[model samples]
Target: MNMMSYAIVSVKNNSDKLNALLMGMKGVVGCDLFAVSYDDIYTVVSNVKGANLIADKINALTFAGVIDTLAQQFTLLPVRFGSLMGSADAIVKMLERNRHEILQNLLKVENKYEFGLKVFCDSGKLMEELRLKSGAGEKMHLKPSPEIKNSVYRDYLDKKLAEHRLEESMLAYVDAVITEIAGRLEHLGAVNNFKKMVSEALIIDAVFLLERDKKAELIQVVKDLQRQNAGLRFILTGPWPPYNFVDLDIK
Candidate 1:
């Protein structure tokens, strides 16, 4: 059976506790969990036929649970799900080659928690509200008058231009909200990433890595942001391992 890896962790002097935790926890499909180490780093792994691993919700959640359990006591770089190799010796050699990148990644996530913030809004309602606020429905001077120009092509261009302008206005509104969020979280020394307009209703998908001690403050910030942006819905989730923050290439 091949070894399916879960996460690369900084175990250091905590091997016993790591082992004890693994003993009580379950890996994918009732398989036993163990660690393969190089220097102070360890990769949590389980034995299973590589072909047997399926892409399903159950397996994904099980893999995340293992990383979640380990993150409680140690700083770690979460390995991608379904990462497998031939044997423990193969894993060890892989670790040896990638040791520098792994340690650097571990250090980046040490003593931190990753938090997610999603801002949602009714797209139609929000755009209308912003239009009313900005007087955007007012006629623009840039549009060529059909009576003066007498061209069907110009009318079509005008319609497309109006649509483009409305989309930009919507994005501008979202950016304003994101700016305020960054300002508030600035003092907490969080590193943040953002994606805008993920769906019709979801305005923003954001994640940040903050010092672990700032959970209370982070909650308060989200609460205050929710209160401030009455038109938009803000949902915050996590104290999770740095899943989104890991950036490394195994050599």
Candidate 2:
């Protein structure tokens, strides 16, 4: 039978404990589960036949839920969906090949948890506000007046200038938000990675790796931020295994 593999959960060199954890747990679509190990790291896997390999939203969510459940019990590196190996022996050899790097990554995230923060805003509304704010500033010098014969050139320049100013304003607004978040997290001593303008509506896509005990504090921080910025929506997902923080790419 084909196998559907998930990730390598850390066991601290105890295979029996890892096996026991996998015993009753279900994987994507309630498949039968088993494990493949290399020293302290174990990849929990399940059987997948012909029709099961096709990607489905429910299957993906179920797989993620499985990983989340396992993460509550042990340190693990969540493998990307559809990651598979031939057999238990193949997984063991793969782990053995990438042992040092895997351990290093495991140690990096040992007792920490990961949180994803996605900040959304009404782009059209926000941009309109930004344009009004920018317009209030000093106007740029116009070399050629719009009333002149080459008014088309002037119009083009004006449009381009407005576009540039809008981009700058958006970036500035994003920076201010990031700065506020950083300041709050600094007080809590959290480590974070942030990306701005991931999508038009999603202005900030960020992840934080923090002590598991500080989950409540982090949630409060996000709530406070949302309260302070009524125009933006903060959607926080996780307490996850450090999927975003893992720094290794095993060959």
- TM-score, candidate 1, is 0.93
List, residue by residue over 1-23, the lDDT tens digit for candidate 1. 89999999998888998999999
Model 1 C-alpha lDDT versus the unseen true structure: 0.88
Candidate with the greatest lDDT versus the true structure: 1
Residue 128 alpha-carbon offset, candidate 2, angstroms: 2.3
lDDT of 2 by residue, 64-181 (tens): 8888888888888888988866677888888899999988888888788999999999999999999888775626544567466587777888789889889999999999999999
The lDDT per prediction is 0.88, 0.85
Off by more than 4 A, model 2: 140-149
lDDT, candidate 1, at 197: 93
Give model 2's TM-score versus the native structure.
0.90
